[model samples]
Target: MRLAPGADLPVEVLERPDFPVNRGALCGKGRSAPALLARDVRLTGPLLRDRPGGPLRSAGWPEALDRVAAGLARVRAEHGPDAVGVFGGGGLTNEKAYLLGKFARVVLGTANIDYNGRFCMSSAAAAHRRAFGLDRGLPFPLADVPHTGCLILVGGNPAETMPPAIRYLRELRENGGKLIVVDPRRTRTAELADLHLQPRPGGDLALALGLLHLVIADGLVDQAFVAERTSGFERAREAAMAHWPDRVERITGVPAHRLREAAGLFGRAATGMVLTARGPEQQSKGTDTVGAWIDLCLATGKAGRPYSGYGCLTGQGNGQGGREHGQKADQLPGYRSIEDPAAREHVAAVWGVPAGSLPGPGKSAYELLDGLGRPGGVRALLLAGSNPAVSAPNAGHVTERLRALDLLVVADLVLSETARLADVVLPVTQWAEETGTTTNLEGRVILRRRAVDPPEGVRSELWVLRELAARLGVPDGFPADGFPVEAERVFDELRRASAGGDADYAGIDYARIAAEDGVFWPCPAPDHPGTPRLFLDRFATPDGRARFAAVTHRPAGEEPDAAYPLYLTTGRVLAQYQSGAQTRRVAELNSAAPGPYVELHPRLAARLGIADGEPVAVTSRRGRAVAPARVTEAIRPDTVFMPFHWAGAGRANSLTNPALDPVSRMPEFKLCAVRVEPLRSQQAGAEPAGADAGAQSAGSDTVGVDAAGSQPPGADAAGSEQAREETAA
Candidate 1:
């Protein structure tokens, strides 16, 4: 991005012509990024509270740092190191994510570390490993999307989330490729599809099984590839055969004929691809759901070829890198499993520590939050780069958990909702003033060059970590060069730690990143160029063959019942980003999507006696959310949609279920059961459905809004008084 001179902030964010991903193009979020750098909307100093639930006041960096370090150390002393939890974010640079995990395990001696990426694509990652023996968002560069013969786009709406990617879809259609969209709503991306399959929410597994059944029934299965390059197909085929077209039609809302057409369209194409996103990956059965999709790709021989495969369209900017370089609960750098003795030994040798010293895997995102301040749970927590108060599933309960913490420390550019509850809030540097690297969805590692110096009171997360480490008694780091305050130094250590692991980055340096625009992972040596397309000749498994998951359809965590008769699904809008911690602060974006509104089909709205623009309460077993009604036929009559970006009365996550996927540990955010009722009292200027974040200047002490009614949903009395007394001791 080119910066313009003479301006207080770098307002001119020029799209680089040299970038291959979006050749001279950017999405609305990219265009409006500068608004976040505005002085009023950003935090420029440290904030501290002397007591829990006390007001946050401005404090010098030293005092704020001391309070955070002391508070955390105190909790660890009384309750053990595992009592301190570190929560990372998907948007953090690879350097920060790596160090965040390292600090948790090494400096704090805690195994309780995880990230928000758990909410993004952990399901797909789990399935990828199950089938291909490795996990990378996309094994091939996104440039191949335009050359495929057919694309089955499942659960993702690139038109809104990643607008620049639409170019490739248009090119594919222009080249005579068919596009099939699978979603519960006819989204903008669905409008461009050759065939749109509007299934009921959480019915993707059934739809995929039905499609595979048709492929087998129509003799579209590639017998050659199946015989030579795949295993366990017999079991998978048996599972698919049980869900015949008629049975699948009963389970999912798609017609039997439409299933046949979709199968034929995808199977007849010489080369095909299936790309899934959060919609199918955020369910309690997400791993099995993705496995079903992959099974279809394998059945039609749509994988391990130049323009064919199953890939995940990752939601966050650095989600791929974040998961790879150690922030995930079960992984170390290079996507190595934490439980593997060999993997732990290698990473331990690199960190100059004993392999046995490293702690075991911790709780997943929701599980960790759910246990906060409870019996034998985390007592002190450190969170960075994420706003879980407005993002996590069952958010009202998550908020209460945050409030019950003995000490909460948050690092961010602005006062996000989560930061408001912190005992200490540290103002961190923004992207333009921070030099770091991020791996994109395609597994390409790219350099993010700093364009300007940070304003006087702001500091980089690297420096903050180093300072905290020093206070915790690990000043010079294990290797003597450890705990360094520079991004490049942290990255250098990360490379060595990830040397021979699956997502190897030993050969990728910052210089190489800038010289090549970006470098794909597994660049094991300096002279090695990179692997642009993987599994072209062989899979990453020991036997060099892809394995099939014998998965079958299952009900969502909470199916729509008589009490909660409608399915509530959540997603993004063109004008907002996740949780709206940053995007909602922008005036232009908020004007486009002023506040939260419930999107329901006209059929459902009419039955509920609700009109367009009327206020309605979306209630579930967890909590209730009131929002303006947007009655349209674009969505399925059985499903209601809401954007989770907003807070206050319209907070969608307040009504979501927190059921965790057994394998991926992903919370069921995409599908849940709910009931909607008209809120006549709140319809006309009687406290709008949501907070106008753009108009409200955020302060560290501000709770943002009356978040979830009188008390946060599921706000139980925390640990017994004896537990608190023990912590105080």
Candidate 2:
């Protein structure tokens, strides 16, 4: 095969005799992944500075690991384990992600370790685990999406976000499946919907409850299925009654008649499924909102079927895997709660660590950030893979506290925004330059083969962390042997960790992955074929019955008022990935979405005296930012949308409210109160103005925004800082 410019040469390019060359399909992003790997500026060394916010100087492996180990030891010894927090990113390999959680609990003896998965999918996870006795991602393959008779998409924009999933949706639509989209904005996905219910932000629960209420009140619910397969139905039904379509219409802005029609269509369908994404989860009431959606599925008898289930479209590539590997604050491997004695004991026995050594559930992302800069709070942080500076909620407060940390260590492939604030920066290998396994959205485990050697001086995160473990004198009993080594060893550890769990993969090994493109989990042995779907008959619950959780509607932490009358919703643009650390560097990707721009309804833009390409200021209680406004009817009049991937002058997080869900602890990234106004020429000029052109001059150094609206030099630094603040909080 011919190589792209600067492409890393693979060890061998053997031709497959049986399979055709074009057998496998590639999405747009996947096709671009190879070119991205060839880009310059990949990090390849360890760096350290003498003081906080000081210049970074290159250091050897030994020196870098020693400094990191010594600093962690010092913090633990002086301020206790809680003083040191570890933040993880979802982009990490399964092996590295697993070790990160184990290192925090055992090596540092700190409970304060959580990954960006919390912000991406925890509420959906919590809801699924509660209702189905398991969280099996989509519960079915993407192929099944088109077979369903009815598809209800809530709080997601799969058409813009997940293009492959959108293809399946389109196929389903073409094959007679009705598509109903529920969201505050009339997103691109909504444009294709048979019906689009524009709910008010944070009103997802009310909408869901209203659906269930209609299904129950009109006798459209499946009584036989509910009675035999579920418990707690009466309580959920009672709660739903209070949120009838008429009442919910007032709260959600979705018309009463439309709500009733949508509910009836979904309830009467032979196979119906409801899907959600980051939109519903990144709110103060995210968990309950998710629970309400689950209730609808249970009431309508839509779950556990081949073409039906409650789906939370995971955001990160490995968000589902991160949760399964115990990167959450309160979880061990296999979705076991850390607080559960039995679960804790099971994991401890597997890892050869005492149960007492594993701390209970710790502070969540929001709480950790709130504690930063406070007396006796987190003094140091170790960040990996995640860029939080431009992504985390309440960007203004997080920035202030981030500069106050005593020690900050960031491990990443580039100088991301958060990494710029680091006391030490460890260069790490990129995805194409490393070998490992990653679980996709449908729980399919695919191998990530190394196409080329890592850049000079750059090391895999596994190698760096293993060296640190040795220097720190962590007991050899920990799975350190798998470090700085082959991907097979890491896969072995993962298999062992998942033994006897719902996501068991002990039977499959490295050899099988090489021969087969991928396999779903629960392949307990070599001869056992992988299970494509989960929960075919009964749930994992003891009684073999799914439970209907009672959920209540709650308002967002902040509401629209005279000062900030517009509701601000944050999301992604087609060209930029989350945080825009890597993709923004690609010229073609950045060219499509050059900089931050507020998406407004034409009506709202007219009211606010704003126009396309005109500068506008969007202000919230937490902070404010200015960006060019694109007036279109894609969104509702009362709501405005902005991509959170951009930082610096138009950082969306800066204007996002920091109110967190009580259960998920995820910030309200989806909904916040803001006021938008046309930016005067003088005001626009007074601000540090260049989309990407002058991004390197001032605060742009922190978020990595270059002068041309591309990722700035140290945007990875901002990512590291954001990760630290979110974890330490």
State which candidate has the highest TM-score.
1
Each prediction's whole-model lDDT (CA): 0.85, 0.76
Off by over 4 Å in 2: 2-23, 475-485, 525-528, 681-729
- State the lDDT of candidate 1 residue by residue for 1-729, as single tens digits: 433322256544666777889888888788778766765667777877766555566667999899989999999999999999999999999999999989998899898999999999999999999999998999899899999999999999999999998999999999999999999999999999999999999899999999999999999999999989999999999999998999999999899999999999999999999999998999999999999999999998989998999999989999999999889888899899999999999998988889999999999999999999997899999999998988998887788888889988999987777877787889898778888999999999999878777767888888889899999998865222322237888888899999999999999999999899999998998999888899999999999999999999999999989988999999999999998878866767867887888999898888889999988878788777777899999999999999888766678888888999999999999999988888864344333222232112222233221223221110111112112212221
lDDT of 2 by residue, 157-231 (tens): 877777656777888899999999988888789899999988878888889899889988888888888998889
Evaluated at residue 357, the lDDT of candidate 1 is: 91
- Give model 2's clash tally: 42
lDDT of 2 at 548: 89
- Candidate 1's C-alpha lDDT? 0.85
TM-score of each: 0.93, 0.91
Query: What does candidate 2 score on TM?
Result: 0.91
**Superposed Cα deviation of residue 413, candidate 2 (Å):** 0.6
